[model samples]
Target: MQLEKDSKLELNDRSRQIGDVITDVESKVRKKYETHFQEQEDKIAELQRQLNLVSARSRRPKRGRKGKEV
Candidate 1:
């Protein structure tokens, strides 16, 4: 009857609201994780660059005393 129809409509509205809230929360979580991953990647890249510079410098001979003629 009419009462049953009204109940169904109310249930549908509540379900829709719950779905919207879930979607919003999921979007926020994804954004936070994406930012965290990007920061980690940037840190790794910076560390790699510093390691390369140190390795390159170490491979070269010293200039003043080491390079002097015997």
Candidate 2:
């Protein structure tokens, strides 16, 4: 009976250890994905700003031969 109890206790300890490892891995993965998404968002915002500047420049009227608006 004592041997059986000891075995049970060891099994429980191992289970707890496995669970802790799993939790640590999950936390690391979540942080990595969060960082990746933030980088992507920053890139998108920069691209949008550049596109707006180019569009504004393109919409401006060109000067004619006498320096008048074409």
Top candidate on TM-score is 1
Q: What is the alpha-carbon RMSD of candidate 1 to the true structure?
A: 7.2
Clashes of each: 0, 0
Model 1 bad stretches (over 4 Å): 1-9, 65-70
Candidate 1: deviation at residue 22, Å? 0.5
lDDT of 2: 0.83
Worst 10 residues of 2 by lDDT: 1-10
User: Which digits, one per residue and each the tens of the lDDT, describe model 1 over residues 1-70?
Assistant: 0123345567777677678778888999999999999999999999999999999998887677778634
Candidate 2's TM-score: 0.75
* Residue-level lDDT for 54 in candidate 1: 100
What digit string (tens of lDDT, one per residue) describes model 2 on residues 1-70? 0123345567777677678778888999999999999999999999999999999999999889999998
User: Model 2, which residues run further than 4 Å from truth?
Assistant: 1-9, 64-67
Q: Estimate each model's TM-score.
A: 0.77, 0.75
